[model samples]
Structures are given as structure tokens and as C-alpha cells.
Target: MIVSDLWRYPVKSLRGEPLREAEVRPWGISGDRRWMVVDPSGEKLWAGEHHDMVTVSAARTGQGLRLRAGGRPDLHVDEPVDGPPVEVRLRGVGHAVSAGDPADAWLSEALGRRVRLVWLADPARRPMSEAHGGRPGDVLSFADAAPLLLATLPSLRQLDDWIAQNGGGAPLEMSRFRPNLVIDGDLPPFAEDTWNEVQAGEVRFRFAEHCDRCAVTTLDPATGRSGKEPIRTLARHRRWDGQVWFGIRVVPLNEGTITVGDPVRAEGTRSSR
Candidate 1:
């Protein structure tokens, strides 16, 4: 198999930037999900709760990050250099520094709510849940659990076929899943389901868990509209443990670069378990 695409969501819940190559660190592709939008209470706002969160796109610049939304002026924000810290509410105890007023105002207006922008300059502040296969020193950015999620084109093709068979409308866009890496080539559908570890290019990864499908995947990325989809169809075939699953979450094992077209090798192709 080979890596077909790579992505990094600089800001959680927003549109991501595609990369031809990425610096892979333990925390994931450098700069991914290091920033996020929060409520006035400092709680991270999610696309599931606020669909508009995905409508506002963010990109990185030399200075910091940039935000753009339809009918709104672009907002350029600089990294918070020792800025006032905020108690970012998370599933676990976590902390982040505020991105200041301009970002807060821009996001608030765009998402139709009062929210603030915060950056996790140091990802080590939030530990991945031990229940999610996190080991000692395992850290995450604003990512829900693991550092990266991987999907395969073969699996997607199978899913689209299932969706059609089940009368679930057109083939879904891969963007809906927001996977960090997309692998393509000769492989059985859902081959990743058995991967305990994989080496893509120079970077190695440890499997964390199967990523459960969520309402976020049901949102139409381009239109900012919500619908029943891949999730609904996933339930018909991939459901287990009371959840529909799709991609697999992975944590990087070593620091290196992962690029598009890099050959991928799954350690022991099938799980020894």
C-alpha cells in the first residue's frame, strides 16, 4: 500500500489543510489541532454541537494562523506568546492559553455564538485517556484521543458500495471522516482493522483503537449541512459495542517525515491476537 494523501487540522473542528509531506512527531503531524475554539466557559466547541465550526476554515501562516469564512473578512491571528492562560475544559484536566480578542470576536461572529480561541502550545499538558490505549507520556493536542487517524481507499470504496446498496444516496466524500492519512493500493476492505502497528515511509505507528463514527462525519463539509450518512450506513455493517466505527486511531512511534506516495507496510499484516 501507499500513502495517497495527508492532512492536518491546525484548528480542531475546522476545515483542514492538505499536505504533500508532513513532519511526523509523537504528537502527530506538526501543528495539527494545536489550536481550537472554546466557549466563554473555556469548553472546547465541537462541530457536532455547532456545525458552523466546520464552516470557518483555518490555515497556518508564518506569524500564526489565519481564519476565513464566507461573507466575513479574513482574520489573521498571531500565536499567543505568553498570553493569558485559560482553563480549557476537556474530558480530562487540561490547560491552554488564550489567542486573544480578535480571534474570539471573529469566531464568535462566524459560529453565531460567544466563543474564544485557545492554543495548546505544549500538547503534553493534556494526556490521552488510558482507556484509549494511552501509555505513559502519551499526549494529544485538541484531538479527541489519539494523535492520528488512518483510513484506506479500499475501505471507502466498500463503504460507498454499501451505502448505495442500502439506498444511502451518493458516494460520500472522504473529507467527511477527516482522516490524517489516507492509504490506497491493493488491500482488502477494512484491512486496517487488523493492523496492530504500521510503518509508513520512515514513521512507525502503534494502533490505539478503532475511531467510532460520530455526527461530525455526517456533516456536509462544503455546504455546512448535516445529514444521515456514512454513519447511518456504518451502523448497518460496522456497528459493534453500541457504536459505528470507521477509521483506526494511531499514535506515532518515532519522529520522521511522512509524505504522499510513501510505501506503507503493516507490521504482521494481520493482528497476532
Candidate 2:
């Protein structure tokens, strides 16, 4: 039971980057989902509705951001060029703040709409999901569940096997799910169903709920193309409760740096009541 892979999506609903080590924050990993694209109405934009483009991968470079895309060259933006203030709804919470402009333009052109980028200042506040026993006022992080989602290699392999048998292509990489962590070791597919606590390195997270699949999963993160195979295959065997869940959501109990290759351990049932 060791940590096999780690990832972070600098922007919401877009391609993510693998990380060797990541700093966990109250909302999520430091750079994970800190920024988002919004329409002219200030409503947030997502890959599900507008799949052509909506994400911009970036890194902190000396107080600036270095960005990259599938076919575009790398872009750099220095400070001083401030973005507009806007409110964005995640899950169901309204996060208000001003953000950087370069990110806004980059995302707007990608989606061919007027969109802006906004950042979260109070990372602890979240948009609670109805699936997670949350109320209108019950704030949640930017994630679907707690703060992170974890999956195992064996579990992914199981899904791949199921997909192949059902005429779906090769099992797509875990990146398609945009999980924060990928663990190794022999575990049943969707074993996260019953986990309550998961330990990785010095960090411990409380497993709270299973992540439901969405149209975003059908879109290719790399090419932004959508298909029905994965969704159709998953529907046959992965449907649970009233929704189709595929990953486990977790809330961090202990905060610390988590790196790849760390042993992963789970305690408790693998099924939800």
C-alpha cells in the first residue's frame, strides 16, 4: 500500500499536471483548482458544457505564472497586470475574488467566449455537494468530495479490463479521472467505496464519499474530445446509489507533504451505507 502517483489541476476542469511532491491546503493542494474560468455573466465555465477548451496548465515562476497548452507555445505573465473581481460557484458555493488577466484571456480564446479567471482567497470555504450530505450553507472545498480523490492501480486495471471486455478501448490513464493521488498494491476495483481513513506518508485523510462520474470524464483531457465508451462501460458495472461513482473523496485529517512512492494504507469498510 504505497502512493504510486500524485497530480494537481492548476485550473478547474482542465488537464492536470503530475507532481513529485505537493503541499496540501485546507481546500486542496496549494495550486489545485485555485483558479477558474467564468462567462460574461460571471458564471463559471467548465469543460462539460464547453469542451473545446477551458483549462490552462501553469506553474509559479518567480512571482509570475508560466503557462502551456496542447498546441500553443508556453506563455509567461508577470505581476502588476491585475484581473477583474468576480464570483464563482463551485459545487454550490459562491467564491468571490479578483484574479489574474492573462489566465482570463487565455481561457476565453480557448473556449471562444468571454471568460475571466478568478482565484480563491479563503481556501477553506467550499461548495457543498448534495450527494455528500451538505446543505446550502454547508461550504465545501473546490473538489467533488473532501479535498482529494485517491485510486489504486489495481482498481484502474480492473476498470480497464472491464472496458476492453465491453468493447471500450484500452483503459484510459488515471489522468482521465483527475485524481489527486494514485496508489499501488492489490486492491479491488472501487475498493475506496468503504474506506474511512487513508494514510499516505505522514498525511491522513478521512474518506467521506464516492465521486460521481460526469460528462467531464467523457472528454479527453489531452485533446478535449468526448466519447461514450468509458461512460457506457462504467454504467454497466459502476453504478451505485442513484449516481455513477468512480473515485473516493477524502478530507485531510493530517496535513503534510505527500510524494510519489509513499505507502498507502486504508482502514474501515470499502462500502458506503
Candidate 3:
């Protein structure tokens, strides 16, 4: 198998940036999920709940962060190095630094609500939740679960075939799942369910858990339009344990650069490492 695509989400919920290569670290890709949106009350906002968030695209420019949305002028935000600290509720009590009022105002104006941009300056400050299969020393970014999510083209093809046989609709896009790494190879669909470790390029990662699909997957990342194809289709065939599964979450065991076209191999059994 080989890596087909790589992506990083510098800000949670906002659209992600596709890359040809990236530095894989313990927390994930180097710039992934370093920032997130929160309300004045300190509750983290999610695109799954506030669909408008997906409309705003965020990218890391050579200088700083750039945000763009339909009809709105593009805005550039500098990283707040000495910015004021703020307490944000992200699954657990977490700490972050405010991105200041200008960035906050721009984001709020775009999302059409009162919101603030908070950067998780130190991802290690928050412990990974044990309930989500976190192990010791497992640092987490603003990513929903583990550090990375992997999806295979073969598996998506299988799901697409199933959807076609069911009702003959359009094929679902892989963007629906927002996978960090997309792999393609001569393997059976759902073969990753048996993997405990994977080696991609020079990096090695241990499996964390199967990623569950939610309403967020029903929304198109480009237009923020919600649909019922993938989610509805996943429920029919991939449903189990009260959740519909798609990708697999993993945490890096070693840091290294991973690039598109790099070879990928499943290295361990489900019980190993």
C-alpha cells in the first residue's frame, strides 16, 4: 500500500489544508489542530453543531494563519505568543491562549455568532482521555480523538459499491471522514480492523481505536451542506456498538516525515503493541 493524501487542520472545525508531505509527531501532523473556536462561556464550538464553522477555511501561510470564507475578505492572524491565557472546556478542563480580539472578531463575524479563537499553545498540558483508549504519555491536539485517522481507498470503494447496490446514488467522497492519511493498495476492504501498528514512510503508529461517524460527516466540507448519504449508508452496513465506524484512529510511536507515494505496511496484529 502507499499513502495517497495528507491533510492538516490548523484550527479545529475549519476547513483543512491538503499537503504533499508532513512531519508526523506525537501530537499529530506538525500544525494540526493547534487552534480551536470557543464561546465566551469557554465551551468549545463544533462544526457538527454549528454548521457555519465548516464554511470558514483555515490555512497556515508562510507568515501566519489565513482564514477565508465565501463573500468575506480574507483575514490573516498572527500567532498570539504572549496573548492572555483562557480556560476552555474541551472534553476536559483545558488551557489556551486567546488569539486576541481582531482574529476573534473576524471569526465571530464569519460564523455569525459570538466566538473566540483560542490556541492550545501547549498540547501536552491536557491529558488524553482514558475512555478514548489513551495510554500514558499520549499527548493530544484539538483533534476529536487520537492524533491521526487513516482511511483506505479499498474500503471506501466497498462502501461506495454497497451504497450503489442499496439505492443507486452518487458515490460518497472521502472528505466526509476527514482522514489525515488516505491509503490505497491491493487489500480487502475493512482490513485495517485487524491492524495494531502501521508503518508509513519512516514513521510508526499504534492503533488507538476505530473512528465513529457522526452528523458532521454528513456535511460537505466545501459548502457546509448537510446530506444523509454516507451516514445513512454507514448505519446500514458499518453500524456496531451503537456507532457507525469508518476510519481508524492512531497515535504515532515515533516521529518522522510522511509523504504521498510513501509505502505503507500493517506491521502488527490487533493484540501486539
Q: Note the Cα lDDT for every prediction shown.
A: 0.89, 0.70, 0.87
| Per-residue C-alpha lDDT of model 2 across residues 1-273, encoded as one tens digit per residue | 778888987666766778898877655676777655677676767778888653556665555556677677776755323554566655455655655666667766656777876666556666556567443444344555566777778777888898888777766877778899888887766677778788888788876577788888887766778889567877888886666768787767656888888877899755453
Q: For residues 1-273, could you state the per-residue lDDT of candidate 1 as single tens digits?
A: 999999989999999988999988878888899898888888888899888778888888875999999999999999997889998888654678899998898888888889999988888667888898899988888898899999999999999999888877888889899999999999989989999899998999999988888999999998779998978888889998899998899999999999999999986455521
Candidates 1 and 2, the one with greater TM-score: 1
Lowest lDDT block of 10, candidate 1: 264-273
Task: Give the range where candidate 2 is weakest over 10 consecutive residues by summed lDDT.
Answer: 133-142
RMSD of each: 1.5, 3.0, 2.0
176: Cα error in model 1, Å: 0.5
Q: In candidate 2, which residue pairs get closer than 3 Å at backbone N, Cα or C atoms, i.e. clash?
A: 1-264, 2-263, 2-264, 3-262, 126-140, 126-141, 193-270, 194-269, 194-270, 194-271
Best by lDDT: 1
Higher-ranked by TM-score: 2 or 3: 3
Candidate with best TM-score: 1
- Clash count for each candidate, listed in order shown: 0, 10, 0
Q: Candidate 3, overall lDDT? A: 0.87
Predicted structure 2: lDDT? 0.70
- After TM-score superposition, what is the CA distance of residue 214 in candidate 1 from its true location, in Å? 0.6
Ranking by TM-score: 1, 3, 2
